[model samples]
Structures are given as structure tokens and as C-alpha cells.
Target: MTEYHGNVHVGGPVQTHELPQLMITKVAVGPMDNNAYLLRCRQTDEQVLIDAANEAGTLLRVIGSGGLARVITTHRHGDHWQALAEVVERTGATTVAGRYDAEGIDVPTDELLDDGDRIGVGQSTLEVIHLVGHTPGSIALLYDDPKGPPHLFTGDSLFPGGVGNTRGNAENFTSLINDVEAKLFARLPDETWVYPGHGADTTLGKERPSLPEWRARGW
Candidate 1:
């Protein structure tokens, strides 16, 4: 059974939820209300923060309380990459990002992950898949949960009602669609739960059948 541990709306801004055992905290940051996650292994207290935007203090506070181990970036967009350096310096944790967009983030990435690299946090090991198009070096985190359905952290690459915005010159809308259809939709089970960078949590089953619609709409 899935349990929600926290729903703290820091400063009446956005709702942040912490799911224990999983030790994951989802913080909504930035003017766009982007969600940055702080995940920790309950058993080991080793934590990881994904996507840093505004609220450097809040991010640091969450990490300090959770005992953060590292920070990981999904892409190089300013919304997700802005607070990365500060978080890294404050937490004293290594940063990891996709090889292609790594340079754009400007922080030194201790490890550059490719299509299929496994990263361990606490007891769970997450498999990283290169889901480019949103950015040349974007990656998605996939993990199999024994107690619950598997999860895919699609970064800015995939969302609840739609995929990520591909407005940048470096972004390819067509390639973004193709990557989601092939990498995300094809591999994971329809029941797999998705934790996107923005908006509400959704299941793969809810988003799959509408792929053609998303494609037709030109997202």
C-alpha cells in the first residue's frame, strides 16, 4: 500500500509530499510550479535530489533534514538547472547529469550516465534511460518497486496530460514524440506509475492510449 507522509505547502506556495520508506519529497518550485524531488533510502538514509529551480533554502532544508547523498539533473533547462550549483555546494554531494546536456548545466558532473546506467539510492537501484529530444542529453529514471508499481521519472521529457515543451532551438518536437513513444511507452508496463517534472502524478495506463492524440496535436 502506498502512503503519503507529507503535504507541506511551504509558505502557501505549492504542495510538497513526502512518501516514507521510499523517503521521497516532491517540492513544487519556480513560477511555472515545477516539481523537484528529494528521494532517500529509508534504510540507509542516502538521498538524491532531482531538478533544482527556485527555493534554494527549501531544497537545502529538505536535504538537511533527510540527509541527502547526491543531486541529479534530468535536463539543462533553466527551470530545472538553476539551483543545481547552490544545492551541490550546500549539500556537499556529487552531481550527475546526462552527458549531452552536462556542459549546459555548467556544474561538474561526477558521473555522466548514458542509456542504461544503474544508480543506487538507499536500497533501490534506479535504471537511467536516455530520453533525449527535450534536450540532447535528457534522461529518465526507471525503477521496479516490489511493494508498489514501478515508476518512471520522465524529467521534462514527459508529463501528465502532455510531453515536455520543445521550444528551444536544441529541442526537437518530432524527436521528443518519437523518444516517448519508443523509449517510455514501449518498455514499461502500462500500469507503471509516472512522476513527471510538473503537474499531478499519473499512471502509464492513463497516458498510453492517448499517444496518437498527443502526436496529432503536435506536442
Candidate 2:
């Protein structure tokens, strides 16, 4: 069993975590050091790629020959979809993105995701969460593992120290923080693992205590 810590860097080795029914592979790519995740079903081998964030060759190499069912762009951010067109073209995978930010994505989104939507990867299911502020249509994915801790793929919404950037807009910051608190912090447990779009992974418990500070700082 390969120990999966979820700590990845550009040009570093990929880390894959094995759950009872699912396999999660994480890699860091692109100049921005964007993190891309590959979720595979142990039973059916069906797979989904989260954020084909740059390095089409690297992403394709990670994807391999098994092929991809869908590519979910967490948000419309350019960095997150830098390799979208190429990945989709090569894999012929269905493109999925948030409803509001779908227009911002360069490629056509086959499916427009909304809050409470469910996506399937073979036997496992990922719940869609619409988080505003970072982007009007930014989204996060929650995979409640049956045998282990819940996993969350947060695009640019929730990070380790604070929520994603909202620029100088107070309203956007407020919306992002509020949604994160009510939807993520309040609803999920501390053991939930968070896989952010960039940087290292963090648990909800590690970031829970500082929620108040994040709100008070108002950045």
C-alpha cells in the first residue's frame, strides 16, 4: 500500500489514495502549481478527472489508456482549465462546469452543474456544491467515502488559511465565507480531507478553528 499524504508539487511524484471502492490520484501541474485529481472506480474502472489544470502531456500521462468519462472544471478560472481543450480532445471526455461560470470556460460545457447535483464515477458519487465569491459559479465536490473519511475537492473556494480570493469586494468575500461556513464547515465533520486547487491538502478540523478569524479579517 502506498502511503498517500496528498502533498504534491510541480514535477513531483503523483500520490494515489485507495479507498474501499474508489482510487484517488493527485498531481500538481502547470506554472501555477494547480492540483489535478483523478478519481477511478475500483469496480468498473470508470474514471473522472477534476480540473485538467495545465500540462496536457502530464495530465494525459496520468490519465493513461483507461480513458476518462468526464472532466469537471471546478470553476471557470483560466488556470484551472488551461489544458481543458487538449485533454477533452484527446480523451473525448464530457466537459462539466458550474452553471454561472460555464460561459467563462473556453470549451463548451456538456453539463452545467448546480448546487446539490450528483456526479457518478463508476460506483462512487460526488456531490456538487456551488460556492460563490471566488467566482459566481465556483463549485466544490464532496465524496463521502463509505469506508474512510469524506473527501472534498475544493477548487478555489476553501483553502487552508482562509477562503479563496474575492479581490476587494466585501460582498463577494462575505458570500464566499458564509457559504463555506454554512455549507462546508457546519455541515461536514472535522475528519473530512480537503483537496484544494493549488497547494497542499488540509482537513476541515485543521481549518475549523480559524473560521472566526477569517471572517473578522474580512479579506
Tens-digit lDDT track of model 2 for 42-77 = 999999999999999999999999999999999988
Residue lDDT tens for model 1, 1-219:
335422333344333333435656677775777778887777787888888766888788767765567788998887887788888877788889888988888778888988889888888788988876788999999877777678778888888788888875333878888888888888778888787887777878999988999888877
The whole-model lDDT of each prediction reads: 0.78, 0.96
List CA RMSD, all candidates. 2.9, 0.7
- For each candidate, give its TM-score against the true structure: 0.88, 0.99
Which predicted model would earn the best lDDT? 2
lDDT of 2 at 110: 99
Which pairs clash (backbone N, Cα, C closer than 3 Å) in model 1? Answer: none
lDDT of model 2, residue 140:
97
Query: Which regions in candidate 2 have their CA more than 4 angstroms from the true location?
Result: none
